[model samples]
Target: MTRMRAKPGRRTPVGRDSRDSLRRFVEMLAEKHPPLSLDAADLTIKDPEQVRRRFGRVFGYLTRVELEVERNVLELRVLMPESTETDRIFYEQVWWPQELQHGVLLDAAQQGFGMMPVPIDVARVSARIRVTGALSHLPGMLGVIRLLYYLTGAATERSAVIAYSRLLDGLRAMGEHAIAETVIAPIRRQEPGHFAYYRGSAEALVKEEGLSDWQLQLARILRRRSFAPVGVTSRRQRADFGDVARALHLDRDLPAVARQISLVEHELLWAQQLGLKVPRYIMAALDEAIALSTARSAAQSVRN
Candidate 1:
């Protein structure tokens, strides 16, 4: 057992309504959610052909992203220098270690089908982000940055929960029970706690006076301008994300998927519009990724 390194969260991380619950949640996370075991999972591929193409692509991209948690942590430190201790504890202590292990399991599963490990770039954050992180240290700016962090966390984990759910079901449908149960189930179970923490923390900040109206507006703008599907860094990567969505069948019901991801932002940033379904920017990003994927396929077909 790798010793869980988080301090039992002793401070109010979010505000009053959710602070107690979120703190308890954090404690639960530290105590209960160690990384899923690597050796215990039977990475047996009942039928490698069943999952080797589309499903393997999904695993490849998923593995690449989870392994990049190290980079995410480094970027977080640079981006939110004024982050709370609890934030530090969650990301560094709990989230990073667990996610890196997820990458391991996913990589192993994909390799069972003879898939190559996806190339990853955990090198460093872009120069732009470093500058922005430095600027985030300005007074009253860190609150906005923190709230955005929570919001980003919420959306990313929600997407993960949905993707893992779909993947789990798909595996069972194909009778890939061993990895489905041991690998995917264990991984999927650990995700909701992360989602809860992010959702609760973001909800706490948005509902309380943690962010001013200007800060909220700023967050809205930043998210609109900069939202990319989690772990996507390039056009090729965006297309790969689209491949994951399609393989998982999330592309078929994009509004529903988009709703899951963008719901919090809509509630927080567009509180007046009760009838709004999905944010335009999120939908646009998804659409573009899928379209890019389609174009990539067409180009490949022409070449072939």
Candidate 2:
């Protein structure tokens, strides 16, 4: 007869402590990032073709990332030895579909520009490889793995909101009035809900697991290494930052870019919520860049 190893003990169901902490975290995130109503916003597209093309490019990138996330979540489910039905439902039914919606909204917007949506196979492959590698060693530690997952999710969703807000604000300042509501509005609407779910889930896991200081530190390290801003992986996409600056009629200098970065820092609520140290030199550099940009913009305006 073949010998079989005994399975490990099941984790306790998420208890009151976890639930209460999660509730508080959810409230905190909601307060920090207020939800904007798309219905109330005017979403008219002035230059339908231009707006469409931009949507196609941006959505094409987003679709890939979403697919990868989906694959990663799936792997987690498969590899997990024990999971509560509630947790399973949240992952498979709720979170998965919500992420897919982000891509769907972008796809619909892309179709408006007369471009064909690319298949998400590339994203699928990349996700499978990366997630497989990450979770390969933690086959049975689903709870801990999930805690890490949700924390990264929280950070990523927040980054998306910050990036979209800036993009929308830039478009409005550039007189590309209609694209803000029509193109960016739907994407933004879905993001808050995504952020809420992950933030809530992460806080609950942290409290339930009674994560140690080392665990939290490990989580942060993992998040910083694996996480990236949505649709911002390449030099080409980075160049889109310049396009956004140009659209706003902002100076396309290093200082202007630094100012944009500063805005990102503010939107993230870095010092207060993130509680990370920003080097003094970095802050000084940002100040100097802002000054230079201001001087250059003034010089150009006077000549004109």
Candidate 2 local lDDT, 1-304, one digit each (tens): 2211112442212224555544444444345534333344454456667655444444455556665556657555654535555456556655566566555555554555565775654223355445644664663345556665565556567656655676677557556666566657656766766666665555455544455545555544554454333433444444443333333333334343333333322322233445344423334433443344455557779999
Report the lDDT tens digits of candidate 1 across residue range 1-304: 1211212442234335565666667778989989888899999888898789648888998899999998999889999987877778889888898899999999999999989988887878999779889889687688778877877888898889898999999999999999999999999999888877776677666555456667777888998888999878888899999888888988889998999998677777775667767878999999999888888889999999
Pairing residues by index, what is the TM-score of model 1? 0.92
Q: Best candidate, lDDT-wise?
A: 1
Q: What's the lDDT for candidate 1?
A: 0.83
Which segments of candidate 1 are over 4 A away from where they belong? Answer: 1-17
How many residue pairs clash (N, CA or C atoms closer than 3 angstroms) in each of the candidate models, in the order given? 0, 0
Off by over 4 Å in 2: 1-44, 49-56, 67-69, 78-84, 122-143, 170-179, 231-275, 278-304
- In candidate 2, residue 68 scores what lDDT? 58
